[model samples]
Structure formats: structure tokens, C-alpha cells
Target: MTSIIVFYLLYLLSLCLGLACVVCVCVWSGHWRGGFAWDGSALEFNWHPVLMVTGLVVVYGVGAVVYRIPLTWGQNKLPWKLLHAALMLIALILSIVGLCAVFDYHNINKISNVYSLHSWIGITATAVFAMQWVCGAAGFLLPCSPVTLRKVLKPVHVWLGGIILLLSIAACISGINEKLFFALKGNATGTQPYSSLPPEAVLGNTLGVLIVAFGLVVLKILSNHEWQRPDSRPEGLAYTPLLQEENE
Candidate 1:
């Protein structure tokens, strides 16, 4: 619980910082109405806007994934039924890719419109995730959770998640492939830099990292892998809470 709070706090704090940077950029861009610096360079130095938004969004996405464990560990756990899991899983993937896209700006010329590709992927993934969220929200509410709705949400949720996961992986792979191609061209620098990269790109990169982290954690929990099994569960026994509770 302490750890969860820390991660969430970090995510929120980072976001606030990002917002501040965005404002700084906007202010710098507009200059003073009364008498502004005629120098046409305020916007250029304000790369923090890009950095803050991208970095913090990624952090937040990661926090979502990170926080899931505490969520599941509670007394009356919120069951992320397979269908609901799809919603979270897709959101994480989109978030990761969105971050990666932004970070790809420096490499855009090398990768050729990675920003566009990422944008499309992010938008599509967000749409599917939003749908999943609505359905999942309904599922959580007793009255709103209609059988027909579950039927409708379940299959669609899986389909959307599956596509988003596969495509997001593809997009991440593409970014790496682009870098590899660059390396092959004899430009050996691994990190790409761009003069005009927007705050959105950083937002995308940060998001990508965080979501990847979150996804791994969630998947690990879902598997209930050997590492996470409770002490009471006989060596190889799975965690069937009722059986354990009854025994206790």
C-alpha cells in the first residue's frame, strides 16, 4: 500500500510538473501583450513542455499498471474478469506506443513519419480502450451490468485488445527497426535528437516506458506465476482463496 501510494504520488507530481512546463511554453510563445521580447527564440528553449507532458503521461500510465497489484491484493478484490483485463491491457499498450511515438521525433526523418504512425495507433487504441472502460465500468455497477452488455463487451473487448497488443508490438518493433536501419547506414549514434521535436513526442516516449512496465506487472499478477504465489498455497498449488480460507 505504501509503495502504491508512492508510485501514484510520483505520477501525479510528475504530471503537475509537465503541466507547468506546458504553461511556460505557452506563455513564452505568446510573450507579453504590453511589450514582448522581439527575439524569436522563446519557444525554442521551452522544450520542457514536450519533455514534461511526454514524461509525465508515461509515468501516469505506468502508475496505472503499477497500482493494479495493490488493487488486486485487497480483501474484497475487484475482479478483473478476462473481459475487463482486456480493457486495462489495451490501455497500457496504447499508452506505451503513444509515448514511443513522441520520443521517435528525433528519429522521424530517419524512421519516416513514426509520429503519424504512432498517432494513428494511439488514437485507435484509445478508442478501443475507451469502449472497454465504459463496458468495464458498467460491469462494476450491479444494475448497469446487463447480461447482453457483457455478451457484447466480452467478445469485442478481446478482439480490440488482441489487435491493439499485436499492432502496438509491431509499432515498437518498427521504431527499433528504424534505428537498426540507421545503424546500418553507418550513423552509429543510438539516441536520436531533433531540434523541433514537440512536447507530445516526449509524452509518447514516457508513456511507452510506463505502460510497458505496467503491462509486465499486470501480466505477472494475472499468471500468478511461481514467484507471486502465497506461502500457504502448497508448493505448486494455485491460489484458490475459498479452499485456503476454509482450511484456515
Candidate 2:
């Protein structure tokens, strides 16, 4: 009972933090960064941060916890699998769009691409996420795959999901700091530097903190063995449709 209560509390906290992260990024970009546009301007670049948080952080985080939710334990696994896949697909599409927006903006401004640590980590995380989704679908969703293979890959998939989320958070934090530095360096003569705790600086730092909190809560939920979906198989293995079908 205590575990269940703790799980729900953590879940609620994660949701709030995730939402705050998204809203913070949007407000920071839209209000302070001159709003959004698609005309290959700085405005267009703002969409990159907004979409990345929405997709990589919020959407992907939700998908990761779906399988572990106690409320969904008695339900059909196939539907949850499909829902997870759909969420991942959405995340992938949004990430691709975010990358395009930044790349296009850089090209238009004659700026170099993928030169920063933030860019390198972000790109790698996205690529790995895309591959994870594809391979997961093939291994778990496909009816013809060997059951042994699915069981072997399950742990790897879960491990990589957590790693990708951490990587995304790191990339976002670095990106936030990098942007603040740029803002401080480009400020007018009388403008306050980042060290002065400017509004934008405060908001960006808050977003980074919120994202990290959200990721930690999510990882907590996922790692708690007590919160995982109940396994009814004789050996206490997770419930999988293919395995059941083959056994029957």
C-alpha cells in the first residue's frame, strides 16, 4: 500500500515537472526569443527547443512509464504495446522536425552545424531513439520473432530507454547554458549579463532543473520493481502475447 501511494505521488510529480519543462521552454522561446517563425530566422530556431522538450522529454517519458503503470497491469498488453509504439513514433517525428528547424536556421545564417557538445549529444540520442523504436517493434510486436530473442532483448531495450532519456536531459541542460552564454555575450552595452540573474537566464535555468527532475522521477518509476506490471507466468516472466500464444 505504501509503495502504491509513493508510485502515484512520484507519477504526479513527474507529470507536473514534464509539463512545466515544456511550458517553460515555449515561453522562453516565444516571449523572450522574439516568438516563432519558419522564415529561416532566429524565430524559426526557437521551435527547436520547444519541440525537443515536448517530444523527447514529455512524450518519450510518458511512453517509458506506460508499461510500468499498475493500473494497466490487468489490461491487454497488445494495446499498451501499440500505444507505446505510437508515442515513440510521434516523438521521432517531432525530433526530426526540431532538428530540421535548427539546421535550416543555421544554414540561412551561415552558421556551422553540430559543432557544439549539445548538438553532438542531442543528435546521438535522437538517432539511438529512432533505432530503438524500430528494433523494439520488430522484436516485440512482430508475431513471428523467436520468443527467446524477445526475452533476451527486453532488458537491453529498457536499459537503453533510460539511457536515452538521461542523454536527452543532459543535452537540454547544456543547450540551455549555451544559449544563456550567447545571450550574455551578445547583449547591448547597458544590458545585464547572465551573472546578473536576468529573467531569461532564470527561466532557462528553471527549465533545465525541471527537466532533470522530471527525468529522475521517471527513472525512479521505471526502476521500481514493485511498480512493474505483474507477471503471471510460472517463472515470473513478464506477460508477452507471443510467448503465451506459442505456449498454448
Candidate 3:
């Protein structure tokens, strides 16, 4: 029972932190960064941050924890698996759109692309996430996948989920710092520098902290063995071998 309670508390905290990070990024980009547009302008670039936070971070994190939720233990695993796959698909699409938006903005403004540490990490994270999603869907969701194949892929999938999330968080932090450095040091009149702790800088910094906190909490919950779903099938449910092996 204590384990159950701890699971709930950690899950709720992670959810709240993820949501807060989304909100912070939206406000930082939409309210402070001249709002959003789609005409290959800086405004269009704002979509990159907002969608990345909403889809890649928040939605992806929620999907990762779907299987860990105690409330869903009594239900069939197939539905949960479908939900997880659906969420991942959505996240991938959103992240791709975010990437496109930034690339479009850069191209229109004649700026170089993929030249910074932030771009390298962010692109690599997104590519890895896409590959992970594709591999998971092919291995787990397909009817032709043999049981042995799933047994092999499950552990790899689980391990990669956490690693991809960490990569995303690192990318977010680096991107935030890179953007702040540019925004703060720009010759925009009346705008205070990062050293001045301006409102925009404060909000951007807070968004980075929220993203990190959310990732850490989710990772902690994922790593807690006491909170893992039990091997025993719930009452009235057909037997399932989802957790038959610890490595899986």
C-alpha cells in the first residue's frame, strides 16, 4: 500500500511538472517572443519551442508512464499498449513539425542551420526518438512479431525510452541557454541583458528548470522497482506474460 501511495505521489508530481514546463515554454515563446506565426518568420520559429515542450516532453513523458500507472493494472494490456503507441506517434509528428518550423525560419532569414551545440543535440534526440518509436511499433504492435522477438525488444525499448527522454531534456536546456544568450546580447533597444534578470530571461530559465525537474521525477518513477506493475494477473483478467522476465 505504501508503494502504491508513493507511486501515485510521484506520478502526480511528474505530471504536474511536465504540464508546468509546457505552460512555461508557451508563455516564454508566445507571450514574450512576439507570438507565433507560420509565414517563415521568427514568429513561426516560436512553434519549435512550444510544440517540442507540449509533444516531445509532456506527451512523450505521459506515454512512458502509461504502463506504470497502478490504476490501469487491472485492465487489459493491449489497450494500454495501443494508447502508448498512439501517444508516441503524436509526439513524433509534433516534433517533426517543430523541426521543420525552425528550419524554415532559418532558411527564410538566410541563417545557417545545425551550427550550434543545441541544434546538434536536439536533432540527434529527435532522430533517436523517431527510430525508437518505429522500432517499438514494429516489434510490439505487429501481429507477425514472434514472442521471442518481443522478449528481446522489450528491455531495449524500455531502456531507450529513458535515455531518449534524458537527451530531450539536455537538448531543451542547451537550447534555452543558447536562445537566451542571443536574445540577451542582441542590440534590441530597451531590452535588459541576461545578467539583469529580465522577465523573459527569468521565465526562460524557469522553463529550463521545470523541464529538468519533470525529466528527473519521471526517471525516478521509472527506476523504482517497488512501484512496478506486479507479475500476477489481476482478478478476472486473462493471464498475460508482459512482465514475466525482469529484463523485459
lDDT (Cα, 0-100) at 193 in candidate 2: 86
Poorly placed runs, candidate 2 (over 4 Å): 234-248
lDDT of 1 by residue, 1-248 (tens): 56557544544554454344345334432431112221233232223223322322333233334323343443332243333344355544545444444445335334434255644654465555556556655553344454565555645654554454444434443443332333233235433443233343343344345444433443333333332213333433222321123231
lDDT of 3 by residue, 147-211 (tens): 77777787899899999899889888998988898888646566788888898999999999999
lDDT of 1 at 155: 55
Model 3: residue 20 alpha-carbon error in angstroms: 0.9
TM-score of 2: 0.93
Q: Stretches of candidate 1 above 4 Å error?
A: 1-119, 139-142, 182-184, 187-248
Backbone clash count for every predicted candidate, in the order shown: 11, 0, 0
Error of 3 at 207 (Å): 0.4
The lDDT ranking, best first, is: 2, 3, 1
Q: Write the per-residue lDDT of candidate 2 for residues 86-156, one digit (tens) a residue.
A: 99899889988999999999999999999999999999999999999988988887777676888889899
**Which one is best on lDDT?**
2
Please list all clashing residue pairs in model 2, or write none if there are none: none
Span of 10 residues, lowest total lDDT, candidate 2: 239-248
- In model 2, what is the error at residue 215, expressed in angstroms? 0.6
What CA root-mean-square deviation does each model show from the true structure?
Answer: 12.0, 2.4, 4.1
Each model's TM-score?
0.36, 0.93, 0.92
